[model samples]
Target: MPSDPNRKIDIECDVAVIGAGTAGLAAERSARRAGARTLLIDDRFAGTTCASVGCMPSKLLIAAANVAHGIHGAPQFGIHADKVTIDGKAVMNRVRTLRDEFVSSARESIEDLPDGAKLKGKAKFINRDRLEVAGKIVHARSVVIATGSSPSIPETFDGMNNILTNETVFELDDLPSSLAVIGAGPLGLELAQAFSRLGVEVIVFDEGDAVAALKDEDIARTLRGLLEREFAIHLGVKVRASQTGQTIELAWSGESDGKKRFTHVLVAAGRLPNLQDLNLASAGLDLDEHGTPAFDRRTMQCGQSSIFLAGDCDADVPVLHEASAEGAIAGNNAARHPDIRPSKRSTPLAITFTDPPSASIGAPASEDTIVGVADFSDQGRAKVEAKNAGMIRIYADETGKLTGAAMAAPQGEHLAHLVAWAIEDGLTAMQLLDKPFYHPTYEEGLRSALRQICSQSQVSFGPDRDEGSVPGV
Candidate 1:
């Protein structure tokens, strides 16, 4: 197949944004709004991994699996079905359709941006403020590197011919009968559960003792329960060796008893930054000791003030939302030219769409404050909806200031917005509790959790009484 024609352009802009993923798109819009001439460049003309292969494709498959699981397991809910089977080919076709829709919709939004900014084939730094794009050289006052990441798999194990990662997973037409997912983080767990629900016998392995180690323990446990009910879990394990056949072979280092076992493996480890082709040394930008762009967190200016870094390439935790947020800041900083005022608030909220879903907002809390929790099983709405197993946990300071909120429940995605609002506004637990919440709603669970913490805090420490230290109260 012939490659797409390079849309050549030789021009100068106030801001040149690289990578047209979530962050790059946001940066271009923000820079244009700030009255800066911006140019956006990406390797994928239609969509990159996140658009075509990563997020969209995975979610599409997961959605189908969820529906299939619901129908297959409906007998317990008193809903009768003769038999339920998943058409693997049909599922993959639907995923392709959704992916195409994403590219179409994304293009419409991209076209709405300022007409001056051009989306080119590829972008690489020639000098500090100069970039080579699509056989044309362009200069800008400031450049933002928003190039995203690609899936990374260690080469210790063989059989990549059968082992699948996020990049190649979408290319699969038929589901594996028995599959082992390496890495029990968000991606691994999500895919494991999705495949299990789709009737694939799935297992997950990871170096960590539990999945989603960075999340709150209670929330992770709840999500783990849902996954365990569907898939086998091999924790604190490493891929040692592998051999492929009609059924892919694998060997792993078990966490307990230090035993090595064999199984069929699927690699869902994580992503590595895409910076190999970009000659950063020419622009005087070098990777930090951490292997990421060494940039001032406050300014996002890498090496020099003229070149800004954004997205997963510069983030401590990589995600679409965080990338876009940082990209906006970078674009605004880029527009400011020489002198720039950076944002003080840099908190990130993340969500994992496993079974009931898991979400977290703000920084974690010290062990001293009481960690208030409300189970969704106690909520009237969840009980009625038959999704009452998850829990909501909130951390608050002595003065009732919201510290953090984490939820493992159905509609946790919706609950996250309220938590984000509370954290952003610095709402007190008493204030949040007193607010009128609609009865029998998932959000009412939020109000209930805050009220419980407020009541307990008041009772534990009387008015004008000095409180002694208690372990999370």
Candidate 2:
């Protein structure tokens, strides 16, 4: 409803949800399911980061790039063809076409809601139990903050209109002839490789030693080496950029102290929570040391009993699945009368979609953990596929429980999911080894790593014998 400047209208709801992204949508559904009269509010665009720009669109581009890469590498598999060329404009058109479909689907979900359930305006906290949205006072019993986040552009590139982020990079009609990608995080690496494969001269710069926030040092080193072979990578360096007449010039120091020119620059540094205009002080909440409202990560509850924070707004976990889970928990709690309890969290899993994908799951390797290694260079399926260039490392505790795993290999996503499930189920290395492993498959590499972990474990598997036989028999 449009705001009336003269007077404010009073609306009542059992639960109020802010933002229209994945978390907010989930929160609204969960609140309604819990028998609460829910109101969802979003001032900005309707589509989510994933559907619009973050995950789906980026993957669409990567899929096109992968096809181009496959055709070029077909000769190694004895499937040679001439004139393998990529049309940058056509590739982007396909990405945008698919991306729009996903966005439309997401928008349809919220658009189908009942009348008065969704509001199109920014909401501010008038008081602990009241919100000012479009000059209407929302008297909600409970509130959920799922406002999400936005890309964090470096202060150094403040006025550079040509700099592209994930939000704008996908909108490009034609790929740049040369690109400089700042920040070697997941988004940066994914897009960098994708552009390079599509015939763009790409260079990636990171202030950190590792890319994609990889926890395992060995796996990070291996992945870095592989990426360096494809694109010019400068790690552990300070990068400076300047405009030089329709061209972006980048200079860095560390392994290389040289300046290079690029047609465009993409900044994939990080993200900032969308919380500044929420007027949180009126709700009796203050930003914590991290400049986000203090909340219990397990419960998603803010200091105030009636308010809860979830998703990127809480800054606990940024992945889509985590956001949905948090929203469900927050919504359920918000709909309840009293006595809010904490919810169980899922096992951590991260993936990077490079040619040989990188994946990590569960707790990071520590001193209390035993490490097992398997090189894909010797794995059967990887050799057969001619993509044998990475390794898998699994970690187990002293008692043989699967602690964590990291892999930079073919089908790492599937392998990571398997490991994450095992870890979440509290399975040990021996139990994982006992599972059936198909012959000559990429999963066999996972089996090999588990076997190594079992060997290094303190727990002993007594008398290697068939399970069909009894002890007395």
Best by TM-score: 2
Q: Candidate 2 local accuracy as lDDT?
A: 0.86
Please write out the lDDT profile of model 1 over residues 1-473, one tens digit for every residue.
Answer: 22222434378789998888777787878888888888888766565446776678889988999999888868777989878878988988888888888878777777776676776667776767777777677788999888888777878655445667887777777776778788887777778888888887787877777675446877877877777877778777665654545554555676642333333456877777877767676577667764666887676777665988788877466777777778888888898877777776545577777878888878775776657787777577777667777888888877777888777888988888788888788887777765666656777777656756776664333465323211111
Model 1: ten consecutive residues of lowest lDDT = 464-473
Index of the highest-lDDT prediction: 2
Cα lDDT of all candidates, in order? 0.74, 0.86
Candidate 1 lDDT score at position 52 = 75
Residue-level lDDT tens digits of model 2 in 1-473: 42332345488899999998999999999989999999999996569889999899999989988888889989887898888778889999989999999999999989889898988899988776788887678888999999999889888787865799999999999888999999888889999999999999999998888887898989998898998888988888888878877798888898668799888899999888999878887788767886788888777888757899888888777889999999998998899836688888889998998878998888898887898888888777787787888988998897789988898888888988999999999999888878876676888777667666766778766687232311111
